[model samples]
Target chain A: MSPRPETAAGPAQGRPRVKRFARAEHRVHRATAALMAVCVATAACLYLPFLAQLVGRRALMVTLHEWSGILLPVPLLLGLASRALRADLTRLNRFGPHDRRWLRSVLRRRGGRPAGKFNAGQKLYAAWLAGAVLVMTGTGLLMWFTHLAPLVWRTGATFVHDWLALSLLIVIGGHIWMAYRDPESRAGLRTGSVDAAWARREHPLWTPEDGKGGRGEEE
Target chain B: MTKDENPARPAGHDDDRRGTPVGRRVVLGMLAAGAAGVAAAPYLQRAYDETLGAAAQNDPTGLSGLLPAGGGFRYYSVTGSVPDKDEHSYRLTVDGLVRHRASYRLADLRALPQTRLVRDVQCVTGWRVPHTAFEGVRLATLLDAAGVRPEAKAVRFTCFDGAYSESLTLEQARRHDVLIALRMQDRPLGHDHGGPVRLYVAPMYFYKSAKWLSGITVTDHVQPGYWEQLGYDVDAWVGRSNGRDDVPTT
Candidate 1:
C-alpha cells in the first residue's frame, strides 16, 4: 500500500477519494441544519419571555416564530427533487446485521464493526428527527388555525408541541456533540467524500469498488 | 427467549447478547421521562394560568390584549382617557339618514326591555373571554323605536373614547344578538368596562361592539372602525373574519 489518508480513525496519510454522501445529501443536511438553528433560536426568543411573563403574545416575534416554523419543511420538500437525496433516503431506511454490531460497539465504547453510509444510530436519529418535524408541523397548524380542530385537539397539540420542542433541542445538542468529536466526519459532511482507505477502515463491510457501491451483494 | 434455544445462533455472535443493556437504558429513560412529566404537570397548569390569566381589573400593562382570558375582559380606550357618563348626564344619539333622530338618557335607555345574553367575547388578536353576560336594550329595539329609514343601509357607531369608530350593515345591526349593553357580568358597567352604556354585538369580535359607545348613525355605507382603519375587517364576525377561524365565542 502506498499510504493512507489521515482520518479520525487513525493517522496514516494518502487514500483514494471515494464519495460518501452525494452532493444533494450534503446540501439537504446543511440547509436543514441552518434552517433548524434559526427556527430554534426564534422559538427560544418568543417562548422564554412568555414563560417568564415578561411579555404577552407579541405580534412581531410571534409572527416570526409562526412563519419560520411553517416554512421549515419547505427545504426538506425542495431537497427531495434531487434523485441522489431520494436514493440516500432509501439507503437510510434499511438496517442490516452490520448495524446491530455497530450499535453494540458504540455501547461497548469500541469500534468493533464498521458501518455503511449510515450507522444504526444515525439512521435512528434521522427517523426520529423526521417524525419530530411532522409532529411539530401538525401541532403548529392546529394552534394557528384554532377553530379548525376541536378543543381537545387544540389543547393536546399545545402540550405535545411544547414538549417535543424540548426533546428536539436535546437531540440537536447530541448531534453537535458527535460532530464536534469527529473532525473527519465533519470534513466528509462538508466535501461529500472520504478517503477510500478511511472509508474501508471506518465502513469495512460496504466500501464501494471504483465509486460503484457494492450495496446489495455485500448485504 | 434464551440465547441457547436457537440452534442457528453463531457461537461467538454478540449482536443479541448486547441488546439487554441498551433495551434496559431505553426502558429506564422512558420511565424517567414519564416521572418528570407527571411531576411537572401541576406546575405546567399553574404556570399557564398565571402567565395567561384573565385580564386584570385595570390592566395597566395592556398584556391582556394578546392573551386568552377564559371568563375575563379587557379595558382599552383609544382616547387614552375614558369619558364618563352618569345617569343624569349620559346620552346616546341616533341620527343621520334616520327618519327619527333620537337621544336617550341613561335611565331612559334602562327603562326599555333589557335583553340579557351570554356570549364569548373574542378579540381579533386571539384572546377570548367566554360566556360573558351583557344585559341591555337591543340595537334593533332602539332602531325600531327610532324608526330606521328605508334608505338607510348601514349603522355607524362612534364611541365616547372619541378616537374609535365602528359600522355594520343595517341587517347586521338588527341581529338578535346585538345589544346596547348597560351592564356586564351582572354588574352595572364600570367606567373601565365602558360603563353607563356600550354596544355589544354578540356574534362579532369584541371590537365591533365598541366600548364607550355614544353614537349610532344610520348611513348609506359602512365606515370602518378605528382598528378597521388600521387593517381590521369591517365585518368582524366571530369565527368568520380577521383571516382566522377561531372557535365562535357565542
Candidate 2:
C-alpha cells in the first residue's frame, strides 16, 4: 500500500485527518475505561477505611466492584468481531526490531526509534494489563466463590487479588498520565482519527508504505 | 441476677481479661505448622484467635481483621478488643418485655438441651464456609423460657464484643435452626469465633449471627443491628437480601 492523502478534514479546524482507530476500537477503549473507572472507585471505597466510613454503602460498593470487574472483558471480546480491531490487536501482539530499538531509546531517555501503530511501551502496557486483568478475574472468582477452592487457595487468591488490584490502580494512573501528556493520542482515542501530520511525525514507520499503519486515508 | 450466682468471684471478670497477651512464639509456631492444613487443627485455630485475632480486634483501622485467620471466619469488631468471658464469668441475660427476666452463666446455658446444626456460613461480602457445625441452646428455647410478652415482636441481641448488636423478628428468632451457638466445627467455639458464646442464625448471613453474645432482649419491633445501621440490610437472609444470590445456607 502506498502512502495515501487524507481526504476527510478535521471537524471545525479542517486539518487533514487519517483514521487511527476504528469505531469498534474506540467504543471498546471507552467501555473498558468506564468499567475500569467503576472498579477502581468502588475498590477505593471498599479498601480505604476513611472512604468506607465516608461512603458507607459497602454492600452496594461490593456489588458494583464485583460486577464491574467481571464485565471488564466484554467490550474487547465483542470488539473482536470487527476486522479493523482484530488487525490492530494483531499489530499490538507483534514486536519488531524497531520496537526493541524504541524500548532501548526509551530506557536511554533519548529520541525514540521510528514506531508503527503502537510503540514498545504501549504494547508492553497493553499486554501487561491484559495479563493482570485475567489473573485478577481468576483470583477474584476464587475469592467470591469460596467453596470452589480450599482454604489455602482462597487465602492465596485474596492475597494475589488485593496486591494485583493495587498494582493495577498504580499502572492505570501512569497510563492516564501518559495519555494526558500526549494530546494527539488522546484525541485519536476520543474521535477515532488523528491529524495526518501527527501520525507521520510520531509513527513514521506506520505510514501506509510500511503496511502496518492504521488506515492512512480517512475512512 | 440468677439463683446460681457464685459470690466469690468479681463481676468484672471480662474487664480484667482484656488484652491479656498470648505467647507470640507459640502462636507463630502453630501458625507455621497449621499453614499446611488449617482446617485439620482446631488448637492452631485457637492459638491464632488468642494472638493475631485478639490483636486485630484492638486495631481501630480494622485492616488487620482482613487477615486470613481463625480457620475461615474473619475477625470483625466494631470496637477495640473485647474483654474475654470464660465459663465462670460469662453470663447471658434475658430481659425486656418478658414475664420472667433471667440470667444464666455458661453452665446454666450448657445444661439446657443442645441442638447441633450443620449449615453453610455465608457472608454478605461473598465468602462461604460450607457444612460447618454449630451446637448450642436454641434461641427459641431461651425466648420461651423468658415467656415473651404478647406485645413483643422481635428479639435484640447484644454482644460483649462491644458496639455490635443484631435483631430478628420473633418469628425468625423462633426458627428451629436459630441457635445461641456455644460450639462450632465440633469444638467449643474459640475466642476469635465469638466464643465463649455467639448467635448462629443458620438461614441468614453470618453477620446476623452476632458474636460474643451476652444479652437477649425481647423487643416490640426490629432494631437495626450495628452493620445494619451502616446500611447493611436489617434482614440479611442469605441469597435473598443485600442484592446477593448465593445458595441459601439453610
* Candidate 2 lDDT over residue span B1-250, tens digit each: 0112345656632121122112222333333432333333345445666788667657886667445431245445555457889988899999999999999999999999999999988986555676899999999999999999999999999988667899999999999999999999999998778899999999999999998999999999999998898677888889887656778988
Residues forming the 10-long window of minimal summed lDDT in candidate 1 chain B: B14-23
What's model 2's overall lDDT?
0.74
Clashes per candidate (backbone, < 3 Å): 3, 0
lDDT tens per residue, model 1, B63-178: 54333232254444444345578887788999988778899999889899999998778876455776789999999998998888888899999987667789999999999999
Off by over 4 Å in 1: A1-14, A50-57, A108-111, A209-219, B1-250
Q: Scoring model 2 with DockQ, what do you get?
A: 0.01
Model 2 ranges with Cα > 4 A deviation: A1-11, A208-219, B1-97, B100-250
DockQ for all models: 0.05, 0.01
The lowest-lDDT stretch of 10 consecutive residues in candidate 1 chain A is A210-219
Q: Which has the greatest DockQ?
A: 1
Candidate that would win on TM-score: 2
Q: State in Å the error of residue A69, model 2.
A: 0.9
Q: Which CAPRI tier for candidate 2?
A: incorrect
